[model samples]
Target chain A: MSTSAAERAVNYVILIVFAAFALAPIVTVLAAALSPQSGAESAGLAGLHPGNFVDAWSEGEFSRYLRTSVLVAVTVVSVAVIASILSGFAFGTMRFGGSRVLFYLFLLGIMVPAEAIVVPLFYDLREVGLTNTLWAVALPQIAQSIAFGTYWMRAYFRTSPPSLIEAATLDGASPRRVLWSILVPIGRPAVMTLTVLAFMWTWNEFLIPLVMSPNGDFRTAPLALAIFKGQHVQATALLAAAAVLVALPVVIVYLFAQRHFIRGMLEGAVRE
Target chain B: MRHQRRYLPYLYLTPALLLFGTFLLYPLVRSAQFSLFSWDGLGASEFVGFDNYVELFTDEVLRAAFGHALVLILFFSVLPLGLGLVIAAILNRGQVRGLGLFRTVVFLPQVLAMVVVAVAWRQIYAPNGTLNTALRAVGLDELTRTWLGDYTWTLPAVGMVGTWVQTGLVTVLLLAGMGRVPRDLFEAARLDGAGAVREFFAITLPSVRGEIAVALTLTIVAALKTFDLVYVTTGGGPGNSTTVPAYEVFQRAFREGAVGSAAAIAIALTAIIFVLNVIVNRIAEGREE
Candidate 1:
């Protein structure tokens, strides 16, 4: 049905207004980061000063934190994606005793809030002398991502054409070979979505790194930004710069692979 | 071969199961154990049974923290749901030009780290921040206050940040749901002498009931799980006005040395989140049938 011209006009107007509303705060921060540190909270265009990011980077030692974030994200994404593929393939294609029960247990990882477990997980890690190590942060997140990853990939695999698998099986291919050589190649989009998601979550994680790295050995970018905020309460420009630095990696990733990111988020909701 | 066939799936599942057992399931069991004892992290323990749970019900600060979370639901979940429904329905109906660009830009907030969001908003809500400056520039000097510091406004202020971050997500999700809606449904409604509003209410609303439920479940859980936003923006501050159960879990366990109390609160929060999600899902499922 054709929408009225007036209705379409109203739609565009509303869309523009809400889009501005969404971008306003971020723009405010960007403008502030560009302005001089002394005055002018958000200089619109003329008063550009780009040194705040450099200063904040060196002062807050954000390089170390960002590097740590990369390491943790790479660790979590690589392991979680591989593990999810294997387990998701099993859940999607194979039947075994207690499979139903095992799936539910995995579901618990997704359902239970991190706050519910971080306390004990911290102590458990500390007891094993793993606190303040990269493992403390990455391990739990790997497990959490695998939980959703397994669920996501299982859905993909369940709907995959059975004929291909049957053909491979008749040709004397093992399940491992089928999954590794055939399905994984065809399932690149699904796997890519999981990788992007796991990377985003790992990059943005705060509570785990905060609690786990008490000695400041493995603090990630977001945690460093928060701590920097506490110390530099008055330096709005520097803080904005740091916030931008911390958020830039994910924002950049989102920009390039937004299709995968949006698809993963919306599809996850729809499947539920 | 028969024996191997039965256990092959298990072999594939071993890595995932091992991770879950070590990190998730094991830790949960230990957290429950910690909740039953009154022990500092370094000292001997005493079994307090249900006392910590009792304290959660009685402590004014703790109760207020959970109460703040409930109030946050209004801004975070309910407000966003209402707003997203309107925006998404409009987008779907108009099939507006440059839909891709609009979706990409508007949905940007959902991808950023909460710390970044909190920081950006902190600048906006500072006493001399953008919000107050805008207020002053527009001749509303008397209306300004330190948003994150004011006891009366801090909770709502923090909650608005949640609203901003979550609205994009809800809008994007609902838009996807609305995309699946067949055009003939709207055409049929228009044929029956329905106005745009009538068409929306009669067809659009009911069609996306499942999406609405999914939106509510995700947003409500986000409201309850809010820690980073509150931690960075207000620190449950001025008083305990902005604290939530998640923040309390961290504060009690780490700062106050109330390990048992923190675990109890965490367990209670998890139960509330789980139960609420189940209700939302069940309602959606019920309506689907």
Candidate 2:
């Protein structure tokens, strides 16, 4: 594993160059977001300003999309997490008939893309008068989230100790109490990873919202951005600012819990 | 009363199963059924009996979309994997400065929303965007054009964005795999006068075979299931040059009302992905032999 200083220097140079390639577009867009559109490309960062964001925000009206995104995200996370925890606990602890088959049945959800079900799903939802509503978006995502969520939580639950369950049962705690009171508390890291992942997946989800909630009344940020971009393709500076605005929350979340996010991705890769 | 405990698992599973059945299972079953029928989503249905599947096979546009997605695999999986191997080797083979910072910077795109990424790349590919500007500065002005708008270059251009987003993912994954390589093997290889490149081919590459398979699976799937990126940036424009199966499926079903063929394309795309997953996993697990 030992190497010469010169070799290490070469490695650093290659690493730094590729790293710049990775980040150059991001920096350029951010710079463009800050620079006014009046300046030519050769102007070279002169006449930079923050007014584009203000202009994009007022013009794009991302506030509504943000609200819908938060609502869908919160609803999907809480509902799916609870269901996954319960089902995962049962699958982990009990010898139930047809459990293995049922587990695989749900795993099918992850294997299939939104394209597969979305076409017919729109009809089913419309027949029930739920199309163009947040519930239409929220319901399918809850199902999608739980599909992966159950697998994640089940992996954690199977590793939980039997003695903890026994101790809780001996204390006369109900099964639900035993889960929320004992095992859920112990499985905090796994739950957090699952929560963040489900949040990210549902928040960044575009296809479902694109199909299910075509009405502007219930659309999320990414969808709004697409619609916005179509209408204002010429507004480069404003579009760049809107792009940054849409990405800000996710970047903030990544900066805070990157370790968990990356860990979840690596572990999820094998199961995936 | 004592026998009721036998139903506890079912009780716990009921909520998840109900939702999964209603939302996931039922809809998939319907897509399969809908593929056999010619219905405009709102009118009386006419059963066409596999006509849609036949059309899916014969359709030239659908085939091009699939072919374009395959080329994207080159950019999304093959190119990134090669790039990943190099960078991961450098980062792991020696003590590099700020490895953590470099890793984070490289992976930043993967974390950003694809919508955001598509929008950013749209600007970078614009006529007067950064790449052209740089090319001008370096006297390589002839090499510049509107990247995502040209019919010939649009798919590759879109694919390059995929490459940019996926490289860090593959690198981090390969680096994680490389960390698991036995230390003594490298030392022994080096002591035997094996050069760095030779050591990499002999030791590092062979050992991280499973990680390579995993990386291929994830990125291949991403490339195949690419909808939002294409949707946001090109919308399958420039005369269908940038179209993919996912985008085509959406257009056929939602836009053109070809419900039967749309369902057929959707199922075909899913079948391709599923087959790829099985094959990739087989390769990943086949190392046991």
Q: How would you encode candidate 1's per-residue C-alpha lDDT over A1-272 as one tens digit per residue? A: 58789988998899899999999999999988887887646553466878888889999999898999999999999999999999999998887899889987777678888898899999878999999998998999988898899889999999889888888888888888889999999999999999999999899988999999999999999999999999999989889999999999999999999999999987765444
Sliding window of 10 residues with minimal summed lDDT for model 1 chain A: A38-47
lDDT for A71 in candidate 2 is: 90
List ranges where model 2 is wrong by over 4 Å: A39-47, B1-4
All models, DockQ values?
0.74, 0.66
Q: TM-score (chain A) of candidate 2?
A: 0.94
In model 2, the clashing pairs are none
Predicted candidate 1 versus true structure: per-residue lDDT over B234-279, tens digit per residue: 8889888889999999999999899999999989988888787788
Query: Which portions of model 1 show Cα errors greater than 4 Å?
Result: A39-46, B1-4
Writing each residue's lDDT as its tens digit, candidate 2 over A1-272 gives 67799988899899889999899889988987887665435343356767788888889998878888899889989999989998888887778789889888877677888888899899889888899887899989999988888888888988999888887787777788888988899899999998888888887888998899766678988888887889778888888888888888878888888877888888876763
Score candidate 1 by DockQ.
Answer: 0.74
lDDT of 1 at A128: 90
Question: Where is the poorest 10-residue window by lDDT in model 2 chain B?
Answer: B1-10
**Backbone steric clashes in candidate 1, count:** 0
